[model samples]
Target: MRRPVPVFLPALLLALTVLGIVTVRLVVYEFGGPTARRKAVTVPPVDGVRITSMTVYSGRLPPCPEPAFDDYGHHDDPVIRPLPTGGPGISATYELHNEDTEVFTYTIRFMFLAGTIQVGAFTDEVVRSVRPGATVRGTVRPETQDPYTCPVTRVKVAEVTKVPDSELPPPPERCPPSGLRLTSDHTAAMGLRVVGLHLQNCGTDDYTLDGYPLLELLDTDRSPVDGARITHGSGGVSGISLPGSGFDEPAHPLVLKPGESAVSELAWRTDTPIVPYLRVRTQPDAAPVTLTLRLDLGTTGTLAVSPWKLPP
Candidate 1:
């Protein structure tokens, strides 16, 4: 004869199954969601700079984008930025301990990641004019990227660059009343480096140009760098080649109307890299503009510049 099943057995089995489901759902929620996506940053060992006092919170950005100026935008005009300053995201402060004897400006790049995946492109945070042996605070807020998720766990450094504020050139800006604007786009491959000089005719008058730009070198203190030679080609940098490298092309006269543009290329190679600044003249008669071009001439102590021409 068959025996009747215990009534408690069915109830216990049901309770166990419900408990398992709840546990699995909680784990999924913890691993992948907005709340779990909150930020935490990690900083690698950096010299003369320390990243500290990081706070991650859930917040929202302003309702609209803000007009701002920087290198990442159009070379000739102000670009609208994401404008996250209304405070709904991850933010961090960095302390720059200037170990050198002179006041220095620090440019730090931060990257955000989610697990093994990067959340957004690396963003640069500037710490300006830090005095020797003194500490100054700077904020690393995302300009266009909203990597609020996993900043604490995922924020990291891509690279860091510094220069004396006095030696640094004016940040790139749009054309002034003079009808011309000058800025640069930086590129690198292995040890070979190139800085593309962009000259724009942003005024009502027609602008004229002939040949390569007048260039000079400056050391960290804005003093002229002795013994550095400026060549007319890429200096035969081995790792890479660029179009319109100013070398083989004969520089001829070109006229650019209002809103037109021209281009040139500066190339060099380096091992330990020196020379932090450049004084560039779009033309000899035109006013010279100093740029923090940061040429790593290595021991070669030479630079190559291409002639100005229309963009490809």
Candidate 2:
């Protein structure tokens, strides 16, 4: 039989057991265990910022949507600015409230709705100097004319990104007019004279053209002809498409490479006095080129030009 256990042995064993329990509790708390869960429950949730009120108005004109709000307290019918005959401008104002305690820089984008098309304009980054529980006002106005048929129905906040100064990609460079050439072919059908304006790329690099070429009629004295106007269309020619292009749509921008060519339709009445020369510039700022061709513009004194595209 063993001798009686020492008194110190029992006390040492009890101390070690208590130390092991303490170590386990510390490990669990450090690793997000029960204690961490209890701490998380007591923490408060974060409150963000929002736009409280928005309004659109122009100089002295009645606000769009008439009443501007609904019974339920939301923006109701869209605002339609009557098409401006002159340059009466349009503008929008927004009231923003920051509910949280943090300072932030914000950006606001406006989407102007015109029929089915939506156009967007934006403001620069605005720093909110006001503290939380305070409100600030921001404004946006369109710089360019609307391209769609419908007037702006209402303005919308497209983006409310929270940043002071965001970086944007650089604007694209306009294509240069190098190694480009212009020529034309004339044909008369159904009492209308049509001239196919052919543009060829004779240089190594590609050339692009959009809309209609700048055109003018010149007399034998090399002076611009008075009272001659030019418009755009195929003059009711059905089934007329660019050669090998298989497209019969309106004029659009086109790209051409070496030896590649595109064509545009130009039509005028045959009864008018004949001009001995034609002047064409690929774009508004480009140098004009003169071609000697006999074109009779008739009493209407107008020329209809179609968009350039690949020949059918």
Candidate 3:
């Protein structure tokens, strides 16, 4: 019995030694393994740059001309252009002076408000190089609902690296009017007259559209309507998303392939005066398409526009 006790004691000691070695190896692997090595690596902080001054232009800015009416229609009502409500497509520009010593790219975000409610946001990037001590400008056009008031609330530096001398991408080729077609359909619901603008790409190449189409009301003689103010979107109404439509999101560039079609919504009041014709320009410089559809814009001269969306 005494001899067996000695043998058993030696076996017990050997098992305990192996257990301790295994536990130590596990502890070291957990504390100094790949995860620990990853934690040790750190990214250097980006030095903050300064924006010396920011000037916001509230009303209709340049590149967008004021309403011009040609004398063609007879009417007793005084024609007044729609008042400016800054949002996605509303023409507003921001002038920013970079105070930093280094060149950087920036993005400007606008907040549209109706009293305390935040109705919409318009964001745009400045693609041109903004050298230190230089002034660069960007435009804010709400592609969605036109809020009653829009103010520049935030500026973020999207990238802090050096901007290339030729940073601007080549401008896209304009789509010819022959390759595209515009048609409209209207429906009356809930006291609002909604007109759907259907744009079809019949050309060989794809066509892209950004922001709202340039809209002008023309009389029977193809002359512009006087005092007709065209405002974009349901005035001051938010959360209007055209379901299953790309325009339901923020205003961004949309591309239509050959044989593909996209739709946009134009909404006005029901009791408004009727315009005999509508002229739409897809791009700023593209040829205008004269539409003969009868449009009723309410008394406010405001029009609500939805983003361009693919039909379901």
Candidate that would win on TM-score: 1
Cα distance off (Å), candidate 2, residue 283: 1.3
Whichever of 2 and 3 has more lDDT, that candidate is 2
Model 1 scores a TM of: 0.51
What would you estimate as the lDDT of candidate 1? Answer: 0.64
- Rank by TM-score (best first): 1, 3, 2
At residue 256, give the lDDT of candidate 2: 85
Tens-digit per-residue lDDT, 192-299, candidate 1: 788888888878999889888999887765678887778776556544345634465778899999888999888777755578678888777777766766687854
Pairs clashing in candidate 2?
242-311, 242-312, 243-311, 243-312, 244-311, 244-312, 251-307, 272-298
The alpha-carbon deviation from the true structure for residue 143 of candidate 1, after best TM-score superposition, in angstroms, is 9.9
Ranking by lDDT: 1, 2, 3
Top model by lDDT, which number? 1
Q: What C-alpha lDDT, on a 0 to 100 scale, does residue 179 get in candidate 3?
A: 78
TM-scores of the candidates in the order shown: 0.51, 0.38, 0.39
lDDT of each: 0.64, 0.54, 0.52
Tell me the tens digit of each residue's lDDT in model 3 across 65-93. 22444587444443433333322232334
TM-score of 3: 0.39
